[model samples]
Target: MCRWLAYSGTPIRLDELLYQPRFSLIDQSMHSRYGVETTNGDGVGVGWYPADSPAEPALFRGVGPAWNDANLREIARSTTSPLFLAHIRASTGTAVQQTNCHPFRHESWLWVHNGSIREFAKLRRDLLLAVDPALFPTIEGSTDSEVMFHLALTFGLRDRPVAAVERMAGLIEAVARTHGVPAPLQMTIGTTDGDRVWGFRYSSEGHSRSLYYSTETAALQRLYPDNPQLHRLSEETRLVVSEPLGELPGAWQPVPESSYGVIQKGADELGHFEPAAP
Candidate 1:
């Protein structure tokens, strides 16, 4: 339903990942090779950790198309961070507005998702009521993606990300079953607390959206050998995206279906996951 990328490791300018690649996020906004829609012009958002407070992530989002957002270009040139999350949106039954755009923030964490809930209107009320009342005020958007964020928070995402996500999927399934909606929910979620970034790819029917992670920095350096741009990155750098950002063959590997991946400095791990029971 959308395209997104999460990056963690050595500090790098936003442009390095958003604009420089042949199939960059911005390029994907205009022409996606592996998404339901090629043009994700509904909105865009970026979240990053400042040099001073790595624990506090800042976000910039808008309802305008990314290709036409001048502010995005300016920020991409001027800002640099060790961890970042960006998304280009294609609306899935919600109003296209700033607050509805993603990379939703709460304290030290930021999150975004790339799919939709089946029959959202039928279950919105129940799902909303299930959220922690304390978190209700922070819920500014009306998208199922943001609702999914708060559900994870209710299940304790800040302290136990993996389990929190599992709980969230369970809640979604429960709501879907309550309404007897047969269509499956598809979710490819990315989240970061400024230190460790996590991405999950799953669906209720067992067929989820696309996701890919970059080859290990050491391996890429050896493969590229003479490419100065890639060589500039520290061995700890890594990126996970909804699709390959460029034509660099072998530079990206598809994340396995029904799995979640964690990315930290020099640490990249993938684990098989099961949908939370309804």
Candidate 2:
């Protein structure tokens, strides 16, 4: 399992979430409170839509613990973006390398995950075969997360992200059943395409990992009228995280079990989620 956070709203320094909070993503890399593993130090990565060129997202990843990465810290303090995702990896059953780090990117989209595809070594071949041949070549790492991303792309992520992911899950579970893995998946995923952010919580079994989104900006402002940061953000400012960054009352809402939600410009959407036939 891993720890990740997706942020979309007003442009702000990456460290504001990656490091400033009491229980920040960087802090989670060393002392996570909710993840299955307390320390997610295998690797780290972040992808953000640059302020000058929001259409092009930039990635800064390293095969080192984020807690001690001077370069990552330096860049985080200097860069500001309207949307971004940062992840600290705790490899489930794969090699610890730069390519295997999360916040995986494809064109303008970025993705991160906090769970695993059980028995991935057994199902990897079948899952890989289902990816579009054109997109298969883009698969740079042997992570179930990376493979999952490309599978979503093959299923039409660019045009219908929610549906594509449902189809992707359907196929994985179908394949897992054939191989005798009763509970084949557990995941809390976050994804975005520069414009909108989507977060999902689901598993083959009913219980899934934790996923949360910040309360609406306007509401938070009313609750903490003295918090200057809250005052600076737009009503749409949002954050989707593997866990809450702090203990602020009513600041984070758990995404419903087996559900998905989107944080975009207009009113955000929350809906039941289930695997659809591939």
lDDT of 2 by residue, 1-278 (tens): 99999999999999999999999999999999998999999999999998789889999999999999999999999999999999999999899999999889999999999899999999999999999999998899989999999999999999999999999999999999899988898999999999999999999998999888999999999999999989999998999999999999999998999999999988999999989866
1-278 per-residue lDDT for model 1 (tens digits): 79999998778999888898888999999999999999999999999999888877889998999999999999999999989999999998899999999889999989999999998988899999999999989999899999999999999998999989998898888878878887558999999888899999998888888999989988999998999988888888888999998878779999999899998755578998676774
lDDT of each: 0.90, 0.93
Per-residue lDDT for 13 in model 2?
Answer: 97
Model 2 regions lying over 4 Å from their true place: none
After TM-score superposition, what is the CA distance of residue 265 in candidate 1 from its true location, in Å?
3.5
Q: What is candidate 1's CA lDDT for residue 60?
A: 97
- In model 1, what lDDT does residue 112 have? 91
Which run of 10 residues does model 1 get worst, by summed lDDT? 264-273
RMSD of 1: 1.1
C-alpha RMSD by candidate, in order = 1.1, 0.7
Clashes of each: 0, 0
